[model samples]
Structures are given as C-alpha cells and as structure tokens.
Target: MDMQDIENKYNKLIIRIPVFLGLALALGIGIGFMISIPRKNTVSEQSSKITEVLSLIQNNYVDSLGLDSTANFAIQKMLQNLDPHSSYFPSDDAPLAKSQLETDFEGVGIEYEWVKDTLFVLYPAKNGPADKAGVLAGDKVIAINNENLAANTTQNTLFKKLRGKKGTSVELTILRGKNIQKISVIRDKIRSYSVYAYAINSEIGFIKVSKFAEKTDLEFTEALKKLVEKDKVKKIIIDLRDNGGGFMDRATKIADEFLEAGNMIVYTKGKHKRYDQEYLATKGGIFEKGDVVLLIDEGSASASEILAGALQDNDRAILIGRRSYGKGLVQVPFELSDGAEMRLTVSKYYSPSGRCIQRDYKNGKPYDKNLVERYKNGELLHEDSIHYDSKQVFKTKKGKKVYGGGGISPDYFIPLDTTDLSTSILNLMRENKLREHASLFAKNNKKILIEMGLDKFDKGWQIEINTFRNIVGNISMNTTQSDYLKLYYKSYLAKVLWGNEAQIQIRNTQDKAVLKALEVLK
Candidate 1:
C-alpha cells in the first residue's frame, strides 16, 4: 500500500498531464467568447470532441508534460488570433490578477522598484509591515525567507515571495548602507487609491484619475464635488492620463456625472441581443454647465475611452492631448473547472457619436503595440501622421467633426515632449536618484517641507541646482538637463509625503495640456 500505490498514482498523473496542459493552452480561446448559460448543440458537440482528443493525448502522449502547463500554453497561443484584451488566468494566478480591480492586495505594504537587478525600497506604506519592522529607503532587499534574492530575481518572482494571505509572515534580509539585518514582516491587506490628483485654485480645479477601478466613480465624483460644490470652481480639468480602464459600469457612472440627462454615455453590441446595451445619463449632471477640459493620452483606454468619447461627442468638454488607446472590446468572465478565470470579448463598445474606438487588430496579435507603430510613424509627434478615413468621421452635438478610425483624436493634440531630456536626465530618473534625494530631503526637512506645502515649495522653497548635482553625483548636466532636473526634483519634493495630492496638482503647472487648457479657458 506504500511504494507501489505511490508509483501508480505518479504514473497516472504523468499520463494524464497532457489534458491539463491542453485545457490550460486552450484557456485563452474561451476568454472574450464566454457563454454564461450554455452553448448550442453544434457548439457543445465541438467542445466534446475537443475534450475527447485531449483525453486521448493525455493518456497516450509520449512526453509527460503537466496538464495545467500544457493547457495554459495552448490557450495563450490560441488567443494570439483574437483581440488583445481577452486573456486566461491560471488558477494560481487568478486571484492576484484581479488585485488591481479589487484595489487592494494581501501583502506587507511597500512601494518597491528593481534597479540593476537589486530590489530597492521606495517607501513603506505608513504603519505597514515593512515600516513597522524598520525598513528604510536606500536599504537593499537581499533575501526573502533566507532564499537569497540578490543574484538573480525578477519583479514577478520577488512580488510572489512577498505577498500572501493576510496575517501571514515572511522573513527578509536587508542590507542598509553598511549593516545587514534580518527582519520579519507580517503581511496585511493594503488599499490602493485610484485618484492621484485633485485640487482647486484660480477659480478652476484639476483632478487626475489614474485608472477606473472598483471605487473610481466614487472617487471621481467626490473629487468633482470637492471642486465644484465645495470650492465652487468655474471650470475643471479631469486628467485621464495613463488610465487603463476597469469596470464599464464604473466608467458610465463617471461619464454620467458630466453629461446632461438623455445623453447617450456609451453602448455595446454583441452577437446576442442580450449582450447589446446602452447607458445614458439618467439625471442632471454635477458639472453639466461648467467649462470642462478632459486630458487624455495614448495610455487612456477602455472605460477611459467611454468617458472621454461621451464628453467629447456631447461637446461638453474639450479633449486635450494625443489620441487615446483604442480598446473598445467588452469582456465577460467565466471560471474554468480548475478554478482558473477567463475574460473573453463578449461585445464591442461604441462612443455616443457611434465611433468604435477599437484599433484594428486584424493585422495580428500584440495589438497593443500599435502605439509603438504610431510612434514610429510620428503620430505622437504630429497629427498629420494619423490617417483618418472620412467614413469614420462623426459630428459632435455642436457640429465639431471627430474621427474614430481608432482612438479619440483630441480637439487639441499635445505632442509628446522629449526636448530638454537627455541620457543623463533619463539616467537620473531611471535610478530614481531624485526620488531618493527627495526622500532624504523630506526626512531632514520634514518640518519645513511639510510646513511650506507643495504650492509654497514649488514657488518659494529653493532646493537649488547644486543640491541636485551633488546628490546625482557628478553627472554632467547641460542647462536643459539641469533645468529639467530642478523640476523633477521639485515634483518629487512637491510630494513631501507619498500619496500627497499636492504633487500632481502642483506639477500641472508644467503640463503642456494644462497650460493649453488654461489658454482656452481664459
């Protein structure tokens, strides 16, 4: 009952591994093509035959690859023929994959970055595990649970080693300056806020929503209320830069706040009539009549496109920036028998003016890399590089022409600015030397920096060019590079404390879109 039984079980597992691998491999094909209820007879028959073949292969395949791995590989390859957003999440990875939308993670809270193959502590979440255990900036994370992560480690590997269920503990070996110390960290649930910027000034307000997550609409509405209802600002700027959207309902809610009742916020269509739906502003909007400026960029996608397209098509707000990321496919989730989750494209979203903001994926896989092609074609640097067909054009409520071949072309296109940036400057930023310097400055001048606040610090406080040159360590900086460094330092310095809203609000002074928007507003 001992060795013989174990050997038999192992042999069975090895023989049946192919099915697991095939199921995993084919997982991606199920994403974006999910049917909640059940498939038709023909579809059912097709699935049965596929399963039978996989079973046969599992029992007789010469190689004994694990079932799950083989299935995952097959699914991944299959998805290449579909849209980019549809994806498969293996059972072990499903939970963590949903962390961003969940807006929290079970882990010892800390912001971290890997530089030159070594993990560096950016800052610990206040009162979180690392902070509570005396982790410090400039400290090198050498090992986790004495596994020695120093020589070779990826961000993914390090993150997995650190995160677990709440109240679980992990040991860390840290090298701070000269001394090496071992610390025990207890992991806990850490909440991540999506709203990165908000402020009211000059009879105008600004808010930057980084992503559309679970509470994004709540955050956006609260931020707008703070600006309009509380501060009574005449105009507002909603910055949706780098927002790779989340829930469609959440985006609809956010768009609803800015649109008048009866306005079409967005709509979606699928093969089945049930998947077809429309969202409209059901009530009077909060800032319905206010002069609004929406800032979007190449990174703005999904629900981001919905809100921006709604506002733009309604002629409610002026879009200021480069074209948004065109991702209009709607995904529905299904759980596999093995507990893995799949997101399949069930529908396609359309902006109010009837523009499908999905970029053409017919060319091939890696549709997301269209941005790179756009850059190569100088689309980022010039609007002339963007070829919009007349058939794809639509008129706003105010008769303003908007193109929708893919992505929203802003009313005001702000070209990418790489001027005054050099290798030296990039190196400084890459190393986060300014962030490191700012951390030290914040510690040493915590009283003064905080007392001064970001506004005062930006305008009045003088950290000086020499301070940057000294901390950055003899790096040759031209005048442009030096000036850029000063602003970079100022931006980091503006963030006297991590999570301070003042940083973005203050740094907008240097934003091209903000400046252009101000011109239009004036």
Candidate 2:
C-alpha cells in the first residue's frame, strides 16, 4: 500500500479495536453484576441514603409525618450509635434540658410528690410564687386552672402546668384538710440552689452539691464561707453522691477552691486542637487549708468525676464511697439550624496524673448497664471484685497508684449497704407506704412537730413499733429493719416539715458513707 492508504488504515483499525474492546468490557461488567454479591455501603453513601430515604418519606409517604420530629428522631438515633452521652434535644425540650443546669427558672416553686394519684405539696419554696400565694405544706392539689387532675395526670404534665412564662398566673384548687381553697399563684423567677451546706457538728461541715450549674462555684464559695466563718468548721465533707454533673468550668472552679495555686485541675484532648485545653488552680482558694473529704458513687459523673479526680490526684482530699461513674468524655453543645440542640462529645478529659477514667465501650458492649454489671460482679460490695487495668496505672502527687480505663477509685471504699434492704422494707418502699406513713404522721402532728422543731424531734421522737406495724399492714420485719424504717420515717418527716438539708442531716445520722467521711475528716 501507498503512505496515505497505510495511515488511513491504521486510524480505522485503532477506532475499530477500541469499539470491540468496549463491547467486551461491557459484557464482562454485566456478567460480574449478575453474579457478584452486594458490598457494604460507604460512609458517604450511607449518609446520602439516609437523607434520600427521609426526603422520599416526606414527599411520597401515605401518612403525614412531622419533618422536625422525624429528623430529630433520626439525629437522636445517629447520636446513640456514636456514644451514650451525645444527644439531640428538640426545640421544645431544649429549654427544659438546659434549665436543669440553670440557676433559676420561672415556676410556682412548690416541691411536690404524688400519693395515690393525688398531688401533695411537700413544701412551697420560701418566698416563691406558691409560698407568696399562701400555698401550705400538706395541701393536696385538687386541680389546676379548673382542670381536675385525674388518675392519668402524670407528674410531667403537672410540672408543665405549674411552670409558665414570668408574670403568668396558675390557679390552683388546694385541699387543705376539709377546706378547699382557690389560690392564684403568679409564677416568678425562683432560685434553685445546687449547694446545700450546714455544719454537721461543731467542727465538721457537710456540703451536698446536686449538680454543677452556672452559679455552682459562687454557691459553693458561699457555702465554704459560711462553714469556715460562721460555723468555725475545721473540716468539710463534699457530698457528690448522685450529682450527674453539668458545666465543666463550674467543676474546675470548685476544684480550684480546694487546690493550691498552679495545680493542674483537669486537661482535655480532642481531635481538634481548639478543644484541647488545661484547667489549673489559681491563687486565693477559700477552703485550701481545711481537711477535705469527698463522697462519690456510681451516679457521680462528668464534672463530679473531674472535681474528685483533681482532688484525689493532688492528695488534697480523701474520696470515700464507691467508684465514680466512668465518663471522661467532654461534650460541647451546638445549636442546629432548626433551633434544635445537639451535645456532641468533643474531647476526653484526664486528671493531673494523666489518667482518662472513661470505661471501655468497645465491641458494641452494653455501656448503660455498667453499674448493674458492677453489682452483678460484686464490685459494689467487695473491693476485691474490682478489675483494674494493669497497664493503665498512674500515680498521684503522693506516689500512690491509681488506675485509668475505668473510673476514679476512692481511697476508701464503702460497700453498698443492703442490711436494711429486706423484702418487707423493699415492699414498703415500693408501695410508698413508708413515705405515706411519714406524711400522715407529719400531718396529724404538724403543729407539735413544727413547735418542737427538728432538733427536739431528732433528740426525742421515736415511731412506736405498734404504729409502724399498723401503717405497713402485717409485714414482718427484724429489729434492724424496724429501726431503719423508723429512721427513714423521721428523715422523711424532717424533709416534709423542714427541707432537704434537714432530711440529709437526719439521714446522715445513719448514712455509712457520711459516717466514713466524718471519720476521714477527723
């Protein structure tokens, strides 16, 4: 062939060869698709699939579904898969959730308990809306805003009804003995103090911190001031037994009060460097010179752990009770575009000894059932049952060994007391008979009890065994159980008449952990 004829043939052959190879490649792909199993979805694909499914449901579903609700639920489920702590709060629930850690909220401000579908006023908060409206303790709430509370009326429903925007009014029909009185209570801002402090004796002061909130450090400082200045308390017991924690800064601030200057309180490390930071104690700590003891348990978590870990690692305080709730994860709240809020776990915190106290959540293990597992493994009752990670050990400032990969173990372990937890006692507690009995006793002798006061009642009053038997109805109990029942009755009575502080004071007379704390302080 000539040069031109050869060039034209080569170009035509190249085009034909590609066409043939493309056909063969298409055939091979079709055969492979027919025989191959489906592979797992990629991260991006799975996420897109979720959005597509949600869109499809919104546009084409048979029934009308709330888009916000659906999206909120999906977000909640997604967060659940990430960790136990990360959570999504809907717009309606966000305020209430945040209010738990707020210093105050607008409400009628009466602590109540439901007895036999009847809402009983435990006590109206001093100078609060209900108190200003002359709502008395022992009053039964018959109705709210003319809506009679039925058997189906839940506590949450009642709470919503009682709480409203500032300057709003809630009309309550209260049954105070035989008199049914209609009272109009104007809801106003009520202070919800997180710290309850009182001198247990001449030398020992007890402070119970329910949670870390916006004003927690201020409240704690005031508490310490009173204990040290007015009460002349040389030792203090910080009771953080069931505090679930709140603001990290509040906890670190309280830790600073106990720790000396320049001491590292806690440090956080995250994927992003911005979330990584260290909290150190500053100068002029109020209670730096006192003998300090902290009481913690499985319910004590997050900020509670932070404070306890700081004190224990520095040997500044003795921790007494069960191991703390193992949560070292630091969550930061982010507001979504739809006004919803999400608390995402951003970092893990460590103590001064460089130990992260977060327990293992690997292999899809049941993390929520950890406390139950601890109970099952006899860890709560026996110190020997605790399985510490051998390789995760760290030392305190005093060279004492502490372990990570779990929680902050106390220097002294107080076993969970099941001594007074008899079947009869349990039944009484479950049936609310004990509280009912206490309520009735307080009501019948309200005048006498009020006149005599908590001190005299603590010193002289005793529930007769016959009276206890009559209230509980044919349940047999040992002397120990009976004594415990009496103690509880008195404590509940004290709570109804006085307040939580008085109740704690009464209960601390028999509280093993409190007793241990006092011993450590001494």
Best-performing candidate as measured by TM-score: 1
The C-alpha local distance difference test score for the whole of candidate 1 amounts to 0.73
**TM per model?**
0.87, 0.85
Q: Which stretches of candidate 1 lie over 4 Å from their true place?
A: 1-41, 52-62, 150-156, 364-366, 419-421, 474-476, 496-498
Query: Model 1: how far is 31 from its true place, Å?
Result: 16
Tens digits of lDDT, candidate 1, 1-522: 133332332332233222122121122223354465667999899878868877888999998868778878777666645766677777876655555565667888777767765677776777778878877654678788988875467544776898899989999898765679999998988876777545556588888887666687788888888787777788988888777676667778888888888999888888888678888898867888889999998877777888899999999999999998777777776788998876667677788899898888786545534555666678988988878868888888888898876888888889976633355555566666677767667777778667766556667766675776687888776676666667767766665464447667656777788999888887
Choose the strongest candidate by lDDT: 2
- Tell me the deviation in Å of residue 421 in model 1: 6.4
